[model samples]
Target: MSIEVGSKVQGKVTGITNFGAFVELPEGSTGLVHISEVADNYVKDINEHLKVGDQVEVKVINVEKDGKIGLSIKKAKETQQPQRPRHNGPRNNRNDQRNQNKTESFEQKMNRFLKDSEDRLSSLKRNTESKRGGRGARRG
Candidate 1:
């Protein structure tokens, strides 16, 4: 069977590498499931998720003119589930802070940054000096 973009197909994992896993689709065609595409979360190691001869359902994300195919196991799984609501997590809070910063004048932002930097530097110096028995302590 010919592989087409956006098609979900069943394939056997033929090989695994640091970057991705190669799957043998029907008719002996091979495609790569990139490490990032293997899962919704971070995939540090492909071996932990797949092994040779494992059967997997993959979505064909792209097909290059040179016969290379890009597949995603996560996309295939996503199709079966309803869309998830985004969490108002730390990332969103940081984005809100960034939006607030955008409204501030350049000079104001620079002054705030400088003040914060000076505070941090002074605190670091105090900690280091205390650890070394204060600046005037004689070394023995």
Candidate 2:
């Protein structure tokens, strides 16, 4: 029951901690299934996915020189699903939107810029005045 990187092995969950689940491998060696490696989705708690004595199939992702074995339950399951090919449809639409944005009239862009600047300056003035006791009423 030799465990090597990239190999899948069946193990029993020996312990569950806040950070990860410890699994006892077939050869009596234990490996850590970090919280991130427990699932494809966000796992706030490892206990939600595994418990002590539960059987799990984990993939050996790393074998550290200090004898630490890193495992991933997610990677073992991911092997069953085929990756989808990326499509260019949404990317082409984004390019079209960029071109449309570039076509805005100079006057329209200038107006928008002026409005944004005015809003920012007013906000800055309000913040500064509040801290300075309305600008004129200074503390003794």
Candidate 3:
């Protein structure tokens, strides 16, 4: 059977490695399910998740020109939760615009940054001069 990108297919795990697991697709074809693509969460060990001869359903993410196939187990499974609707009507947009208006403009932000830096530098210089009390003075 010919495998196409974005197609969900069942395959058998033929081999396991540190990086990923090798799966045998239909018609004697094989693909690599990368460690990241194995699950939705962090996958520390491939052996813990898959073993030799285990059947898994994977989504064909990419088919390289060199005949290498990329598969994703996470994408194959559908999410159980219903999606939330977006609240982006005119009323919500007015609130967003009000929030944006509260932010400082480029020149205003630069002036604030310069003033803070000048204060910090003056304070540092005073502290340094007070601590030195005469750089080359003899301790005696």
Please tell me which predicted candidate would have the highest TM-score against the true structure: 1
Put down candidate 3 lDDT per residue, 4-28, tens digits, no spaces: 9989899999999999999999999
lDDT of 3: 0.85
* Of 1 and 2, the candidate ranking higher by TM-score: 1
Which residue pairs clash within candidate 3? none
Ranking by TM-score: 1, 2, 3
Q: State the TM-score for model 2.
A: 0.61
Clashes of each: 0, 0, 0
Sort the candidates on lDDT, descending order.
Answer: 1, 2, 3
lDDT of 2 by residue, 1-140 (tens): 68899999999999998999999998689999999999877899787889899999999999999999999999999888975544457776756656788978889878877997999899999889978798655688
Clashing pairs in 1: none
Please give the CA lDDT of all the candidate structures. Answer: 0.91, 0.88, 0.85
- The list of candidate 3 runs beyond 4 A from truth reads 79-140
**What does candidate 3 score on TM?**
0.58
Candidate whose lDDT is highest: 1
